[model samples]
Target: MSDRRLDDSEMATWLPTIRFVQLLPQVLDRTLKAETGLKHSHYAILVTLAGQGDRAIPMTELAQIAGLSRSRLSHAIDSLEERGWVTRTSCSSDRRTLTAALTEAGRELLRTAAPVHVAQIRALILDPLTDAEREQLGAILAKLTPGVAAAL
Candidate 1:
């Protein structure tokens, strides 16, 4: 790694972005837990599964999409399974592969949780952004995603 430190200009930009990254999740988790008894990760898993045409997704792919480690996802799946919100099964084509599917209960929970989650998201993040700023933010984040993922 280079020894060069972040300059004042870079620090000014980076500090708030890092702070937002740290705080946003806490805010989201708090709202979801209070309203629905679901953590943000659980809610994300449900939303991802719901988007997958209600079909089972392989555990590995699900972890990637959710930005979780395999072990963390497995543990979350276990909790969700106990709650009857998710199910895991061995893949028919590849017995070594496991798949996760959202249950009817999960769908119901998501339907109820989504509006409240969305409103919080708007209040915390989107409501402050002008249309052009929102578009710019999207573009900037899109450019960052690949590097962040690779770093992870």
Candidate 2:
């Protein structure tokens, strides 16, 4: 493979974009943990489960949707289960597979956290952008998602 380095124009775009990707999650995670006593990962899991309409999802599928490894998802679920926020049970048809379901407490927590989280997201990300810029950003990010997922 050729050891081609990024040109100056490419660097200009890539550096800031990569830095934002790295730093935004840390900032959001810290804020979420401080306000809700949950890390960003936990918040993501809860959000995903909440969106499933009270149905349980297989652990593997949950891990994929949550962008977590199976072990990490399992560990997080363990903590959530201990806190009465989530539950894990054997899948009815496949006894070997475990499914995770959000508990009522989890739903309550999510309801409480959603407003604050949405506000934070707006303040940190969307509020600064103009309507046109927001649309452009959505389009740009949509273009990028598939490649990033494939790389992963």
Candidate 3:
């Protein structure tokens, strides 16, 4: 624990940032679940896989990109596999190395799910911020992401 405590000025900035970080996932998860029967983490995993085009990502890399523990990602992958949305396979030469890819069903589900998720993001987050504020937030996050990723 640190010896220093947040002062009023610091808390003023930190409180809402913390709240946004904490609550945003819950809000997004609820909306996604209601509209698409998918949670935000699962959606994120899908998006990450989709973003890579035809490539099948190694499970370790997927876990890092999806910001999930290896076990959590394993469970999520199983759930996704059960829904016919993803596939996991082992390398022929190296059976211990596994990779994951999105199936056609996953792509089709994203076609329906993306709009709802994007709309909610705009409504709850982006639409409220001015262009300048959005720029600043983007820059701030970009600067902080390296340190945060290193910690993870």
Candidate 4:
């Protein structure tokens, strides 16, 4: 059997959407590395750990929230630890459970990095959209996210 080709209407939407999805991350990563000496993945890990405040998050949970595999998260954590941006501890409730928490330096890093990220986001995405378009985009992504997540 042959696959059906996308018609013009579908191509019009999919082409730009796919291109933007593929390109935007690279753009952000380049900007992040240039200004902050961090890649987008490392930035994501820092942000995730920081979100939990004074508490440490278990490795499994952190991996899930960061959308990274255990091994990948482990490597990221190791790098972050080297930078004093993150620290890992054994969960007191379960000694075998390794946990990660953001450090003062990590928060400091975020203080520096978040603005760069936000500025890029505003310049690239939010600023370009009108209020209604932004609302519609939010709605559209909300509708699509579940199925996309389920597939993963």
Candidate 5:
């Protein structure tokens, strides 16, 4: 095992990344909750559905896309449905399968929520970085995110 400790530069880089990883979700949750009466998780699910072609996806596929378990996704969907933000339908080709779709209300919610979400993201994440740092951060995150997702 290497006895080498993190250098000052390494510490500087790692500290913010660690703190951001910890703080970002809370910040996002706070913003989304305050602005839209929704949690960040709920907003993410709604955005995923809204962005999809036809605004529908199979339950299992949606869960995978959202990085959620089937039960968790189902519960979120249930909450959305209760809010009239989404609806579930039997798949026409396979009655055994189900699809979740954003309703008109859901799309409208997304429209209202997106600007707030983007603003929060800019304030908390993007605006802090210098242009070069932002570019570097984008490249680094793009490179690393897939590996992180794969692990999840």
Candidate 6:
């Protein structure tokens, strides 16, 4: 079959995949916001920094990891700084380099919010799938992530 030769059934099957790619984030964002007072972007930033532990990352690297533009990341960081959930430090090795680290308050916030986030995930996502189905979905998403990154 040629690349353009997708028939009705193939097209129909793929439509949901495309739609899911578009809608999942917004749905998740709503749930996150309602439950934890955290936007999806803020949650992502906090989780990323928390995952990094005591080792701080440069702002640019943090932006890339969180899949945000530099400016957006800067704004989010500024907000977090204001909330005292993060601290920005000048790198000793390179005075020009700045790093963002999760503060004790940030860790506490994440710990407090973790259950709400988990419940949101369960209600909006995992509970909708069987164990096997969840595994398959995870595999599919993992496969797609690299292609999406490549395009970006």
- Per-candidate total of colliding backbone pairs: 0, 0, 0, 0, 0, 0
Candidate-wise lDDT, in order: 0.95, 0.92, 0.94, 0.94, 0.90, 0.87
Cα lDDT tens digits, model 5, 19-86, are: 98999889899888898898899899988988885756999999888989899999999999999999
lDDT of 1 by residue, 1-152 (tens): 99999999999999999999999999999999999999999999999999997689999999999999999999999999999999999999999999999999999999999999999989988999999999999999999999999886
Predictions: Cα RMSD each:
0.7, 1.1, 1.1, 1.8, 2.5, 2.4
After superposition, which runs of candidate 6 have C-alpha atoms over 4 Å from their true positions? 1-7
lDDT string for model 4 (1-152, tens) is: 66999999999999999999999989999999999999999999999988899899999999888878899999999999999999999999899999999999999999999999999999999999999999999999999988886665
lDDT of 1 at 104: 95
Best by lDDT: 1
The segments of candidate 1 whose C-alpha lies over 4 angstroms from its true place after superposition are none
lDDT value, residue 146 of candidate 5: 95
Please give each candidate's TM-score: 0.98, 0.96, 0.96, 0.92, 0.86, 0.87
Ranking of all candidate structures by their lDDT, best first: 1, 3, 4, 2, 5, 6
User: Where in model 4 is the C-alpha error above 4 Å?
Assistant: 1-3
Model 6 quality (TM-score) = 0.87
In model 4, the number of clashes is 0
Which residue pairs overlap in candidate 3's backbone?
none
TM-score of 5: 0.86
lDDT of 1 at 78: 98
Write one digit per residue (lDDT tens) for candidate 2, span 44-87: 99999999987999999999888888989999999999999999
* Local lDDT at 78 for model 5: 94
Over the full model, what C-alpha lDDT does candidate 2 score relative to the true structure?
A: 0.92
